[model samples]
Target: MPGPPILTSPPKASPGDRVAVLSPSFAAPGFAPAVHEQAMARLADLTGLTPVEYPTTRRLGASARDRAADLNSAFADPEMRAVLATIGGEDQITVVPHLDPTLILSDPKPFLGYSDNTNLLCWLWTHGVAGFYGGSTQVHLGPGPHVDEVHARSLRAALLTGERLEVTDPDESEDVGRDWLDPRALHEFGDREATEPWEWAGPPKSVTGRTWGGCIDVLQWILTAGRFPADPSVLSGGILLLETSEELIPATEFGWIVRSLGERGLLEAVDAVVVARPPASSLEVRPTKQACAAHRQEQRDVAIETIGRYNPDAVVVVGVPFGHTRPQWILPYGGSMTVDGVSRRIWADYA
Candidate 1:
């Protein structure tokens, strides 16, 4: 089958434009109003864009159809320039089927999210619409004392200013943050530690391609549900984005998932693979700093070995901060990304 049509970033949002904030997966904002409110205020102050929330945005346990209604309405509205997910959750797979492709295809706009939001992103990709792969009001904007600089830069790049920006290591990260119910969750970050440099593998040549893929766990569900392309060639020459969520699946499991992609011809179809820094700890279980480091290293090794088996020439960069981690760098989904092994740098084009 032919590859997807060339995807384009939606028109950039102006300072005073309205952006929809919807909870298409889980209504995290409803559960933690304080964090959600703070995120809203910060969003307006930072970008000068108005955040318009739909009824289901704050209505927890909303049916998938109801959530899809909000999304459809947002896309159909002439004034809404962009749509943002409150956060990722388990049920977006159900929500995606209810979405009206005509609404999105008619006015394709940037939708920023990751994790479970990958379902929507993948759905949007199928229709040839581009979106950002990271950004969560509940996770990145609300709980921290402030939005991390890397996040702020990429957020603007995705929304207000369409520009090419280097994807950088923030040099520190946290696996998870304070409990949402805790009052301190409003002004504090979770336990954070210094980060290690990203590990580069495969050939030394630089490769640039439009990006595809998302949280590996979510990709599994998408594939099992028959939502992905019947022909892996749709991803031909694209950069594959891969990351695990806070569930902290074992390195072996990650390898298994990649192995499946390899069997399906996806691993060999891509020119490069970009792996986000996987979160190694969660609220219920916090490992020692040393243990966390070891855990990340294990995943890094598995990713390198598995991808190499399928495509030894595929450029691989592991442990870049983009998904399921604090200080996350929101990257382009279905937009241009350059993985330069020679320069040891990465660049994402929000345009």
Candidate 2:
């Protein structure tokens, strides 16, 4: 029931530093070695950092305890400057309780991931170590024909230097991505969709605070498991960043989830809420262009209505390109960010 501690940004990694790329969730690397190899190549090409893999990094059926052990090893290794997830999976929540917080706290290093990896980020935040909330090796680096510039810039800022950088929407985005199992997936980046300008709502003022929240469904799981800080006040004055995953939950379900947060006093505690563009089309369920548009609009309306009911004064922005969508931006899980409703700009201090 204690609130989350004051967060401290971890030391940045420099070029030539050794970074650990592990599978703390599902071992997607084991199933798709070609994709994993490409991702490692891209990581090296983009940042000039050496990637070291752990025992569970490619062990498909590794247990939660084994994954946690890899995390412990990564944190305790002096040569390892940072830890990155090979890719996200469905049950990283199972790995959380097994983590050795003392090891992580003793040598805090930047951890990068999204989706199911939200569990780990929330765990680190509670222990006061800030993490970068995007940059999955498979999704961001492997499947695509080339690395995205937006992602590349944000990754560099998060890992190399501390600087105030503006978060901008990518010129293009894709809800559907390539299939890692297919060889052609390496050459196909999926179709690019025409992007709409970000929609802003609420007061015409700016709010600066530490960023929190992640994939909505994963956050719900975290809350349900009692893994999040029990004290809601810890989120007071902070900025809430929410996004949906490929599951593309219905608008009503999304509203219900937001309502649950409101009932828990989370919605009212934040200064602003930023919603990422939902991925309406998935590999299993590819909707038509018209259907995708309608789905996105309904989600936007539901989010605004739900937030308005809980905290009318909170600033809100939708479609910020930081989710399952392509050309994603890396957000600091517990680092400083400025949300300016007046200027319609968002800046993050990646320190």
Candidate 3:
């Protein structure tokens, strides 16, 4: 297990290049064609890149092998310069084993996704390819009044510009958007609320290192499947990126997961830890505003306290918008990020 120099960022995509818009996990585009089509249009308009779909990109419940074949085709094609997931799903772990690593190695491209897509990102990371951790056309580019400024900027940085950008607070966020079946889902943003300033903890020092980790639930599955490095030291001096999805698991469960990582020698191996603003409500589980605030706060407290118990010197920041939340920042999965505790700011290198 190696670090840093092992995984390299693939060549950035240029304007007019073709990007594979894939649904390797769940065929979200198939369920909501209107939103999906709008997302594709916006993706083209924002980055000046064409969105190319594969055979399984819009075929709901496609077999894992079929999805992998689509992914293989995308990576093998000389015309495809990057790959983006339509949205995250539950069973990408099954899809990863079927992928053709030879094709990915021969023609590595910028792969952007989050949530269950973490499985593929981690797979690529282990194979010496870096990927972007957030970008889902179904969730971010579609269903909103417009593409979020932060999301649009990060999408461009990841796919087209290859520039370093600060990950800033978007000031407002939504736990989950409207149901895809709703006609309003095409243009209206979800119920959004004011966001608190990101909470920072640990020593007042700065650290810049490659990032790993993703949706905590999916990360647990990855660990259970033995997909992570056998040598925890491979993550030494790196940054840990953690976030939760719309399932809205309890704060206690979140603590237990982080505790497991610390027990595995992962906590002390990292120089910094970043936790996304966990989703507190969902379409069928909307809580009152006060309850939502409390849930987020409790999760934040447990993250800081648990990380401190294992590595008090590790710089920790909670509630940066990424992962399942709206206004997400497409951070690098295996690329460099600067977490400055003194200034309380974050910068990601898309190159």
Return the top candidate by lDDT. 3
The TM-score of predicted model 1 comes to 0.99
lDDT of 3 by residue, 85-196 (tens): 9999999999999998989899889999999999999999889899999999999998878999999999999998889999999999998888998989988999998999
Q: Candidate 3: RMSD over Cα atoms?
A: 1.0
lDDT of 1 by residue, 1-351 (tens): 787567767999999999999998999999999999999999999899999999999998999999999999999998999999999999899998888999988988999999999999999988889999999999999897899999999999999888899988889899999999999999899988899999999989999999999999999999999998789888888899999998889999999999999999999999999999999999987888888888999999999999999999999999999999989999999999999999999999999
lDDT of each: 0.93, 0.90, 0.94
Tens digits of lDDT, candidate 2, 84-111: 9987888999999999899888889999
Clashes of each: 0, 0, 0
Better of 1 and 2 by TM-score: 1
Residue 213, candidate 1: alpha-carbon lDDT: 93
